[model samples]
Target: MLQSPVEFFRTLPKKVCPECGEHIQEQAESYLFECERCLANKEE
Candidate 1:
């Protein structure tokens, strides 16, 4: 089954981090995603 780009995005779960409950930032042309703050904290 094939789906349009708009429909694909519409079906995606809310862009949010499971760690800190912050909204995840959108990354263009990327399949993996994470909240900016949580990612930064992980580097510390």
Candidate 2:
């Protein structure tokens, strides 16, 4: 029996990295996402 990748990822929970403060979605999205700290640094 084979497990579907979609099914596997769907079961995972979203996590936010304290160091970066970015929300990591269980499923990937099209748009690029960055942490607030990273974004602020980019403006500098």
Best by the TM-score measure: 1
Name the runs in model 2 displaced over 4 angstroms: 20-34, 37-44
Model 2 per-residue lDDT at 40: 75
C-alpha lDDT values of all predictions:
0.77, 0.65
Give the least accurate 10-residue stretch of model 2, judged by summed lDDT. 24-33
C-alpha lDDT (0 to 100) for residue 41 of candidate 2: 82
For candidate 1, lDDT tens digit of each residue in 1-44?
89999999889987777787777667787554667777788899
User: Which structure among the candidates has the greatest lDDT?
Assistant: 1
- Candidate 1, residue 8: the lDDT equals 95
Checking candidate 1 for backbone clashes, the offending pairs are: none
